[model samples]
Target: MAKGLLCSAMQMTWRWFSPDRTVTPRRQLRFPAYTPNAVSLALKSISKKTKCLPFGLRQPDRPLLLGGHSLDIVHCHQYLGVWFDSRLTFATHVHYIRERAATRIAALKALSHSNLGALYSVLQTFYSYAIHSIVDYRAVCLVEVLESLRLSLEVLQNTVLRVMLGAPPWMRLVNLRAESGFPSLQHRIWERTTAVIAQLCRHWPRFTVSVLLQRTLDRPPNPHPGGDWILLAADIVRKLDATNAICGGPDLPDPAYAPAPPWLPPLIRCVEPTTAVPRSSFPAVLCQDSLSHVAALSTPDAAVYYTDGSVSDDGSAGAAFVCDEWVESWRVTSSVSDYQTELVAILGTLRHADRHFYRCIIIHTDSLSSVCGLQTQRYTDNKYLTAIIAVAASITGQGGEVILHWLPGHVGIAGNERAEADARHAATFPVPTFQLHPSLSLLLRRVAYTVRHLSWEDHQFQIYEGSRSATWYAIETAYAPVTVPHGTSNYLLVSLRHLRLGFPCCGQMTNSNPEPCPHCFDISEQPLLHYVLDCPATSRLRCGISEQLHNRDEPFIWQQRLLHRHLPL
Candidate 1:
């Protein structure tokens, strides 16, 4: 009877699993078997290429034969780059990642050598792509790893940072991380784990993992010997105050996998050049002239619809469409970004046009991103873009036409202004919910933003408060837009960073009893500040700078000058 049941199960598996002849048992296979009898039966009918790994605490007492050959019992196996041992501890996988990351760190050190002349940004990029990627691969599985193993990964990150910055070994890890703008591995893993949880929550019922997570949350707490990723993720969500943010509603659609249908009518786009002069910079008269030109180009009999989307300060999103027939507005989930809101607005316009069978529909929107996305017809993983294409194709396939016009927003256009106002109004007041799912990209972005702010706060209290860097911290608020410009030489970039961090190698900073300035004999205690502002050695150069400032009639603030605010000149 057991043999009959086994044969029946194998037949069913072959029939359903390989119905299309795409998968066959003849292919290379390795499976973990829970029982010795099952392993024996599986090996007898399988190809010699197959390998069986017996699981559970009990070992097979006797050797099992398959075609007169004894089967080999395996203790470890690799699948999808992750090693799984009989104990399921993931220690082997972590060790493998450490070794691989160490090799990549060596490569980074070679490239960042002084003779190679690689820029800080280039080294950072290599670290992110080569070293960090290897460490971050499948990090969600490492949540339950030993604390020692996790710290080993962080040590590798510190080594990479030191190589990139060429900082002394005495430098603090917090300062090095802040200087390089890289978060700690722990924070990164938390961010990644939270992002995955958000995605699973956002697409509940679609993924099996999501279903299991939901079940785990609903059940009474039980001891999990192997550690529970779902429970860990839930704890993180609560700590982040994102419990409400990740709750999935019943109305969200499953992601569309099929390609967009072809449209019969050509999509007409009147998009302005991306590099055109800024509308904000245009004079009032020019703005009016441009608006008039846009008004004149509208087809007399065609339906002209204006669309706009708004995002409030608190992250609530709203989209609205205005036309001669009606003005409609609705709010969407706060997790949707302003860009996706714009796409939703345009999508609404197309849906309306298709419903009423309008012959020619012209949509005026302020979102250049939406227009460009439609123009390119390359919707890569964006479910909204895919749906928009599908709807537009449906409209055009039925002999109707859709035209998209990109217009500068808030330029006193009547319909556009009404749409924008309605969108903002919808965002302010409770309106009909749009029933759109939270975007995965936007959710991940929120996680990243929260992690960055948390890291910054930690840095402020731990590193900035008790260090010599406090001097720069006091004055940092004075410089509103202090940023290192792209393409700066590595030497200048490093110098500026050191100065901002209050560790410049000046005599006063480096010595307890500093001597007078060697070049100008200045006796000021703050030698770096005096050297830039009052040194007679640089009098001729200062004269040229003062003349330029005088010509521009701007005040000569020594702080701003020292901060490289005038470097653009």
Candidate 2:
């Protein structure tokens, strides 16, 4: 009687709700196991043996009975597209995503290793389409699952990078990253999730999810805390630039774009910022070495040390000390300046000599400041300089003399050239640990740049009309760890900044004003977009730039083409 009544009631409601349409009771009903006849048919279509009741909710003492059918009881089941279990641990789901992404990566290994030049775009597309989706699906919620598996995920990403770049697995992490042009897995996750949160706040003005985020953030980090999400969001806001995302004071008024002050990470502050190192105080003897001198000095008991430091375009720094007996490199923190790296290298070389019991030291370097500092500033207030000066004074104590030689860099002076190579290798090889602290302002500026570009990218201003500029792309995308030609990059940077700030392209818009373009008249303000894309005056010049581009033939491509016109074919 209960079975008959339930079926009759369901049929009546189904019919009433679908008066004009065909209501297939078998197709639409969720718990169709109520009908055993239909269950056999449904079981035949699906590969599963049985299905579980809903988990994580209260259950009744009585068994579910409908249409005289008996459904098996289980602990885990798929409901409404997501899997649910008795525990709700989400371990199964995390394992699935990992396996799925790894499988997709394996499928692309052949294409990744292929010599397909232009088809590399295809490989990237495949990654974006097949693998990134698997990795990024529901990432905001699954951040903890991903974070715990970060080392494994990084290996997966590195595997792809090695295959894509045609590099061996033993290649340095820095080199693989530079070749593949991908940030770390952790960084990508942060950027993606935060950007999504930023997008959500923009699109949905009144989402209650902000309240959940706020409550989670208000609490502290605990093993059983709200989740890893709180820690993740707090990490981005604290270490990365959280305050600038939204308007107002400390406790952000709008919780959407603005993340509140993180509870986990203590605010970053430098106790004592690095000061300028004074030049050495002692009078230094300069070594004027010819080919013959170099040859003679490359013999026994001669303690000649080569020191060099390198700063790349992206602001990464490295210092190297090379001698027949000792060689190693130190990666400098981003906050450290190029000049400081040079001094640090020289200082390190002096310390190395002191440790080895070498009574006499001969140094060859390309840094003028390194040579000058030791040559004159013996009694200086600077702490780093004072130590270096003491090292200089001590070396000459027991049959010890110091020869500070200036070698022309990269002109085949064997020792100096080796030091330079080692410096570059150090900069581009291992990841920097940032053990040396630089000034607070420099770190703040770097954080600001990251926030601005990320906001810019999230805003996707590039797609808007008349916003495309070579300078913007070159600055935002190519500026990180990628070297741009110095002169051209500078011109592009200045042109773009000027154009955005309403500085006139010609004479009319600024204090250093020029006459307006003859064709556009004084009514129109001349900006970078105007000259590159719209201005009739530069049409011929723009046409010539377009013609020079071999790979691209569009109007917008002209902007970047002209920007990089100085690049070699």
TM-scores, all models, native as reference: 0.74, 0.34
Instruction: Judge candidate 2 against the unseen true structure and give its global Cα lDDT, from 0 to 1.
Output: 0.51
Candidate 1: where is the Cα deviation over 4 Å?
1-58, 63-71, 114-116, 201-204, 216-226, 249-297, 333-335, 375-398, 431-433, 463-465, 469-488, 504-560, 563-569
What value of lDDT does candidate 1 attain over all alpha carbons? 0.66
- Global lDDT of each candidate: 0.66, 0.51
- Tens-place lDDT per residue, model 2, 96-154, is 66677777877787665432332444566887778766666555645565345566776
Ten contiguous residues with the weakest lDDT in model 2? 1-10
Show how many residue pairs clash in every candidate, following the order shown. Answer: 0, 7
Say what the RMSD of model 1 is.
8.1
Which candidate has the highest lDDT of all? 1
Model 1 lDDT at residue 341: 90
Can you give the lDDT of residue 455 in candidate 1? 64
Question: Candidate 1, 555: how far from true, in Å?
Answer: 16
Model 1 C-alpha lDDT per residue in residues 469-501, reported as the tens digit of each score: 543433542223235556555566555555544
